[model samples]
Target: MQCISANAIFGYKKSAKDIHKLEIDDETAFIVEMIFDYALTGKNSIQIAKMLNEQQIKTPAWYKNKCDRRSYEVDSKTIWTSAKVMKIIRDQRYAGDMVGNVRATTKVAKNDNIRVDRKEWIIVENTHKGIVSKEIFRKVNEEIMPIKERSNVAVGESRRQGFCYCAYCGRLLQKENNPVNPYLFCVRQKYDVKNGCDEMKIMTIPLQATLSAMVVKYVSSLIELQTFVKRSKMKIFQNHKSAMTGDEIEKEILKLKQSTISLNQRYHEGRFTKEAYILQKDKIRIQIEELEDKKLQILNGIGDKEAQKEWEKELEEKIEKFKDRISFTESELAEVISRVDVYSQTEIRVKWRFMDFTAKATDYLVRAQKIAC
Candidate 1:
């Protein structure tokens, strides 16, 4: 007989430097061990709950909380209230199996207790390392079977705290409300909390608006750059890749007219399906319209080349206008760039937006260069 410490498996803190130490399979085994330890400790759920809380251990809810900027807290009530623990014990994931579909329900109207039968179970086993010994696991399931109940909805504070950070101080913007106004203050200067900055609390709305305008401006510049590239490619297609020009349009029109006459003869001889004949006939009609349009454009080009050039020039002017307005958004600037740490008022260093945009732009230019050649 061998003994195992529960902490050795689940308690291994995953860090970047030691990420390769654990395999995914081993992690699942560890989770099962954690579950097993909780169930077999011979304590009722509430007693186990208190021990976890007293130790300041993180619960699943606290671990999953995205707004945890400063602290992680787990209430004992959450541990006693969760249905997931019971569900985990019943789950076959811990049993080293892919077992599923243990019950089927009847569709009876107006019955408060609709009938469900356990005969339809499809059990698959030996899928992974067992979380618990089969005998102990099975016994736990049987013991808890009589007390199974539906879960309760968890209640807690929904208002997000410490979400907004100060752009000036790089500290969490503490929330405050007044009858006249509401604001976020840098905890450092206001109350000397950890990582607090000495700057006065900043007003939220105008700062947010200024940042938003800046981001809008920046996006507009990028879009204008993309549009410039599009226009350049379109010019190449218009001048070099045109399918039907002056000489070509004349030849295409003659061919289309001949094809239309031949198709009409086949229709009259009942040599085509009605649908096929109509479809082919309509295609020829569209080809005729397209050929005519091309012919007219080519003929008019002799006199209207200057006007078309002016229209193209006007489009380029619009693209230029869009490039002039790119600005930084407050949220994006603060979050993405972090606060600019100023050691001196006169000396400043600017950090641009993420390298992602620059890399994308470089890749685009490389592809565009290839296309141009």
Candidate 2:
């Protein structure tokens, strides 16, 4: 059984012998069941949290620390938040499933734990006795949760559904369709006005214009860069060909394959530890795969003028659509921009997608300039 931590999760007690063998804590299991029942009655996470707080129910963090002295200390005054309630409701473990690889730490951002996509999550069903039945959990999550989320906005009303956020509280800004002026405001401010930001609101017209202008600028810049590269006769794809010949790539791949065999031999001879062998093998595998892709690119004539022209034409069309107005679709906007932080109409920050392309383009241009010199 894979080691699991049930300390923070309510309604589950971890076994001393094997943490994976989780037992139901009857006391907290009742709360878990009640939360699901509340959801079934059309109560949202916020309402459920409010209800829990009203009842003076101890939070999972508080309960964990009280039960175990060694457990991480939480404030005695810790109260149930909507986020915490939603987390518990969404947890598959409460429905008798063991989930793994739900989150990962990247080498670039070691301290930050990012959620892995649900499709990538490894789940084993009937792992332990459930606090709530799987059917009830699924209905609450898939049916009830989505309905509660969309209960605020009318169908086809949210243009900037997932992208826009409140700069003050960092919560998603909800759209308000006022006859005089439609605007986005921090929804939290509506509930907790004292704690929430009053200044976190922006008119939709200006916000859309800002986003449209940003998209236009981004596409325009890319188009200009492509034109500059073409005019300079420093083909971006051609540079890759010049960097490494097809024969050279094949040779490198062969060397990597040979290294892999040598690594296996060392592992069998007990020279390389299992951890070191696996790590080195993975690195070699990645290098070989990259070399193979380069070889394929060269073979497929990716440096041809037709391919370059097609790529430029695509960018030109994208810019043309957003040139006149904010005609860019959600999918198109999502392709270029990851998020939009709306501080106000005058101060909107956009986190763009395809940042790697910009970095690569700059590197290519610098190398091209050096070669020209």
Candidate 3:
């Protein structure tokens, strides 16, 4: 027998007030209140389920089916199933976070539907609250979400997976929703109303692979760019330093100050009107202030020598540790690499941090080839 009352879920009890006060979305609050109500009434889930059935209250599935104009054929016996009750109590959707399908299609397919990979799930935070503590709900979800196998193959290729766009037009050209059969589609088809992508029809997987491979190769070219930047950064810094001459800046400052003094004298003698004098003085004052700030910065030094040295030491340590390692985890990869852009066919373009260039050029190339034909 439960000790809690149903109304305790609503109108706020001392124990649940802290959680209730939290600004959660309406959907989440509704779930939380429902759970609290069930707990407070001292009734087990079955008793509550029976009560709901007696009242002919709608279930989430029933409501959704009704909204879609679909027929409800399920037995009342299964409507109050403990699994369904537990699922509602534990759902994270009430916690104000949006969790959604990462790879599954809206259209039912010929073959068995497989679960989407966790990496594929598009999640956004601050969605809602739960019936229980967030920590408890998270633990329950961990038990529920599909665990990935080390060597598990994804059932279907994602629609926009590993895709990049044209910087000029933002048109994404690639094959999407590839399973046993795939289609190539232009991003402009979805976004633009007029004169969308003026391009070729959906090429087969093999052509996409080839194009993707070329794109990857194109991005790998940036390795040379990384090398070039590494070699030239010191030279660039030296050139910038040389351009700032203290004596020339000081001369300009003195000239501006002299002009300001002359302007003030003309105003005191009533040779200039008040508004004209003020406008001229304001412009000169701004320039003088800028020159002063530059002079101060030069005196204090333009760069952080200690911080720079610390970073250099940290880089050396990381390089030493990773020198013998064959590869990096995703986090390490993210630290060095920026974005990967995909182009039409099998092209993979990559951008890296200033120091070095590294690309998963081989994997993408192989995938594209496998996809072709």
Candidate 4:
């Protein structure tokens, strides 16, 4: 039987140079482990850091700060900051990857850390044993980031965030609310635009509601199409029956015409009198007219089969686009839709994940209001 400490960091010890190595000290390893767990369990960085402080868990900065040597109250500020907790959680080191020079100093040789461009940073993957799975770490970051960003974001689902893009410049839109209403502004303009974004800002509620209405119509059209197809299939049998009857009538008319010719030939050959031949011809003419009338009665049922096939094919293709489509809620619009291009009130184009439901992008008058936001 062998025993091992839960805090063991596989290969090295507590030191500055050793920080980049696969090894970590017992205390730091435990802290990293706890932060990872807390993040997975929905604890934001602030909450995790506060919990750690309350538990009196010595931070990794204890050595640098000389907390024990100094006469400090050991409050939340002295112990750990939310940024420290987030940094630990964001570390690629736990995922068996190495990242270097994440922060650089200002040009004048100050110890202060400044954010460096991601392109300038060094990143190496699969360097050592990982404490947390990369998938878990990825999920934690994804979940935590949205939580942190939610205060400003109007509304979004976990799957729907970051799918939005500006209609004009194609920059992503960020959710925001004014005292009047919630809207999405072009992130380019919101953060950094050389001059300004020429794109129109989208009001979230009206835009979402309009999208949902368009999807509803799309879905309704599909249902109606399916019903029409069923009725059309039923009419197929009736059409075949009518066609057969028309063919039979045509054959009968041809036979009667032949008989009438034979009768005319008999009269010319003097095999029958003029009156008899005339009467016989008249009978055949009447029979032919009757058959033609019967054929005409069923003519409407006959249709262009090739044109019908094409129409059905087109409907089938449209139906295929919405196979997974369902009755959508307002929020679920984000699930099916990838993005929306607001050309104007009437010309809003919704690019769906499956396909564009608003194919025409018309019919904005869902209410008394002339158009959607």
Count of clashing residue pairs in every prediction: 13, 0, 32, 0
The superposed Cα distance between candidate 2 and the true structure at residue 221, in angstroms, equals 2.4
What would the TM-scores of all predictions be? 0.29, 0.45, 0.29, 0.32
RMSD of each: 18.9, 15.7, 18.2, 22.4
Please report how far candidate 4 places residue 196 from its true position, in Å.
46
Candidate 1 stretches with Cα past 4 Å from truth are 1-156, 159-163, 167-171, 188-196, 235-362
From the highest TM-score down, the ranking of the candidates is 2, 4, 1, 3
Model 4, CA-based lDDT: 0.59
User: What is the lDDT, from 0 to 100, of the residue 310 in candidate 1?
Assistant: 59
Poorest stretch of ten by lDDT in candidate 1 = 1-10
Q: Which stretches of candidate 4 lie over 4 Å from their true place?
A: 1-20, 63-77, 105-113, 144-373
For residues 1-373, could you state the per-residue lDDT of candidate 4 as single tens digits?
1112222232224234443344545545677788888878887766777687668777665643442433544332234556567666666667877666666766666665666655787877876667778988888877655565323322112212545565565645667758688877654443233333445577777777777677777666666656755565565555455344667878988999888888888888999988888788888889888778656644532333464455556656756655565445645666567777655434566766644222211111111011111
Instruction: Indicate the residue-level lDDT of 371 in model 3.
Output: 24
Note the residue pairs that clash in candidate 2: none
TM-score comparison, 2 vs 3, better candidate: 2
Compose the digit string of candidate 2's lDDT tens values, residues 3-122: 455353678777767765788888788888888999999888888887887787888777677787345556423566666677778788899888888778767646666667678999
